[model samples]
Target: MRFGMGQQRITRAECAHVAALARLELTDEELDRFTGQLDELLDHVAEVEALDLEALPPTMHALPIANLLRPDTPGEVLDRDEVLAQAPFAEDGQFRVPPVLGEAP
Candidate 1:
């Protein structure tokens, strides 16, 4: 299907080729549907490209952004013994977890 007045059109064969490269198995109906959808998307892109955006400043986001992180400051450290006592399993003054990779402890 054609896109807008002079925009390029997406063909079913091209869509099929893309699907093959992506290891997709689309039916004939799906190919037709996707081709039309892609054509519409390209038309929208063309319209956007035709807009007068020279005066507008380029921006990553629509709204103003600011860092929300708090200041990093030194904090009180917890006692190792107290923290180990709260754990379900502790060994040699450390928290003990089950073997993950079948390695001998």
Candidate 2:
């Protein structure tokens, strides 16, 4: 399944060759199915490459947008005693979460 800028050759024989290399024994029906899927995928890629995207600037988002956010500011926090009192489990000055590894308690 070699794909690059040049061209895409996703024939049944090619798919079969790749499958054999991977020690996979695919049935003829599966090979044909994968070959057609690969060809369709390559055709889509070719279509995308044929588009005139050069006129447009590269952008992470498709639309013009900005993060509408408030400025970070210092604020009052929950009291330690009050917060700890609501915890299902707590030890000393921290919440007692279950063990991350080993057998479950």
Candidate 3:
């Protein structure tokens, strides 16, 4: 099977081969469904390739973008003792979090 001029259609055998390579065990119904879906995707790609895109400028994004973050500048640091006082569990001037690796605190 072929799509658009010379774009070879994705075959069930090829799809099965790819699935085997990826260690997948696909059923006949899945192969058929995926082959049809991949063929449709390839057809769309071929259609895009057939377009004359030389006149259009390439873009990384479809719409214009700008950084919305505030400018990074030195800010007042929170007092360590004050912040630690608010924690439910604070020890040795730092927040005390539960052990993660099953190690004793």
- The CA lDDT of each predicted structure is 0.85, 0.81, 0.85
Task: Identify the runs in model 2 with alpha carbons over 4 angstroms from their true place.
Answer: 1-9, 20-24, 68-70, 87-105
Query: Tens digit of lDDT per residue, candidate 3, span 19-84?
Result: 999999999999999888887888888788789999999999999999989999999999999999
Q: List the residue pairs that clash in candidate 2.
A: none
Give the lowest summed-lDDT range of ten residues in model 3: 1-10
> lDDT by residue for model 1 over 6-90, one digit each (tens)?
5557778988998899999999999889888887887887779889999999999999989989889989999999999999889
Clashes of each: 0, 0, 0
2 or 3, greater by TM-score = 3
Candidate 2: tens digits of C-alpha lDDT, residues 2-95: 4665455576888898889999898989999888887788878777877998889889888878777977998999899889999987889899
Question: Which residue pairs collide in model 1, if any?
Answer: none
